[model samples]
Target: MHVPDGFINAPVSVAAGAVAAGAVAVSLRGARRELGGTSHAEGGGERTAPLAGLVAAFIFAVQMLNFPVAAGTSGHLLGGALAAILVGPYTGVLCVSVVLLMQGILFADGGLTALGVNITVMGVVTVVVAYGLFRGLVKVLPRKRRSVTVASFAAALISVPAAACVFTAIYAIGGTTDVPVSKVLTAMVGVHVLIGIGEAVITMLTVGAVVAVRPDLVYGARGLTAPLKLRVGGELVDAEPAPVPVAARSPRAVWATGLVTALVLAGFVSFYASASPDGLEKVAADKGIDKNVEEHAAKDSPLADYGVKDISDARISGGLAGVIGVGVMVVAGTGIFWSLRRRGTTDATPTRVPESV
Candidate 1:
């Protein structure tokens, strides 16, 4: 969940900020290896960087849809399980972080002051816990696309409550208000457990869709299925490698399709999202978690609260904001990933000397 300003004390917020900064720095370096490593181990193909970027944008778009969970509470995609399963864990962290940064600075969804808190709880914690659980589950389950889907569902389901617990712990230590720690812990985890079901369903569906089309592109599926062993007279030997795909759809096509879907979801489908408060906000209001909550610095921005400033029609204003958010997120994410991909190339490329030397 996006933590707004003044939820936690200043000291804890600053500490969380430092932790978030370090986590992001580590993710940037780790993403190079995940994006640029040898084929089959990292991304599906050479377009890994762009694919990762598109995944980030897709996460941003889907997160706008706050589907109703229970009563007046609603939940949206966290994207940690989705990204970690589709791309890689390191890149997943970077993906959610990018969304948080954009939301804080431009749309005022998350607070700039609590940016680090959001990143730490939503990005780092979710990715780590979900990915860890995913890897472990895949290890024990049957090595198949279905197994990956199941693991994704389970991991994503757990991650939401895990993040809620983490936030509760942080609040216990650094809450600005006098809300009881036990109550906050119970409410946050309970409501988010319901939210986690929504997360699991979305994660399972998305991961299953990708696995069906391009299993190779799924990072979590990599290496799960081992090469076949064949009996060669007396001793067993490795079976013949599968032929390279010839008529398979181009990655650019897949990317374009995904981008279009994101635009459609954000621009139009988001209108149906629940008007009630999300899990975190509802818990906060009911529990008085943020008595010291501060106004968002970007409250006056053109796209604050996911609506255009001057548009009179609710549908039109929200639609425009969503479209703008998708466009900006895609551009920003693509640029960052492209630059990282280039850097990875530079690092991998060997230096050549002149004949004169």
Candidate 2:
């Protein structure tokens, strides 16, 4: 959920900001390994590096297509579970954080001052909880493509409510309104539970589609089975690796497909999405949590509220804004990922040993 400004007092907001900063710092370091081919199949980092950016853009697009969850309440993709399964946990955190940042600064969908809280709750909490649960489930379940999808569904389903609970806890500590913590908690959790189902279905379908086409590209699918070992001269050695298909070696096809899908979702399909308030928004209004909500600092931005300023046609203006958002997100995300990938490669390089020594 995007916590707007004035929802949290200054002290607690600053504390959350520190926590978010620390989490981002750690994720940056971890993303290097994930993008450097150290954490997945051979050459996976190179392939994954490009896909990470596309994943962020896709998440941003999908978030605009909210679906009706209940009467007057809607929900959208959070993207943490999907990102972690597609890329890796560290990169997943960065992906969601980037989307949140873009939404806050450009779309005014989230509050500038509450950026830290949104990152902490939506970015950090979702990735950590979803990835952790997905990993655990993957270990206990059968090692198959279907198993991975199943795990993705379960992890995604739980992450939404988990985030809601965390937000409730944060509000309990520093809520700016006079609402009762118990009422807020009950309402938040109840609505979010319904929202989580939609999240699970979306995650399952997306992960399954990618895994069906290119299981090697999915981080969570890696190491599903131990490599076969053969005995040679009374010693065991790893079996010969299979050849990778030429298409699999190049990420261009997948990248193009993903980018096109993101463009379609945000630029065209979002027009049909539900207009009802999302779970958090509804709960906030009902529980008086918005009693102290402040106006977004970027309320006058050209792209504020996912629409272009001075554009009379609602469809054209919203579509243009969505397209712009996707473009910016992809460029920014790719730059960050590529830089991390390069740094990782450099750090992984071994110093040359002297032959004369």
TM-score of each: 0.94, 0.96
**Which run of 10 residues does model 2 get worst, by summed lDDT?**
37-46
**Top candidate, metric lDDT:** 2
lDDT score of residue 354 within candidate 2 = 86
Runs in model 2 lying further than 4 Å from the true structure: 38-43, 245-249, 353-357
User: What is the lDDT, from 0 to 100, of the residue 204 in candidate 2?
Assistant: 97
Candidate 1 per-residue lDDT over residues 243-337, each given as its tens digit:
54665456776788889999999999999998888889999999998789999999999999899998999999998898999888888888887
Model 2 C-alpha lDDT per residue in residues 170-197, reported as the tens digit of each score: 9999999988899999999999889999
| Candidate 1 lowest-lDDT run of ten | 37-46
Cα error, candidate 2, residue 36 (Å): 1.2
lDDT of 2 at 90: 93
* Local accuracy by lDDT, each model: 0.87, 0.91
Clashing residue pairs found in predicted model 1: none
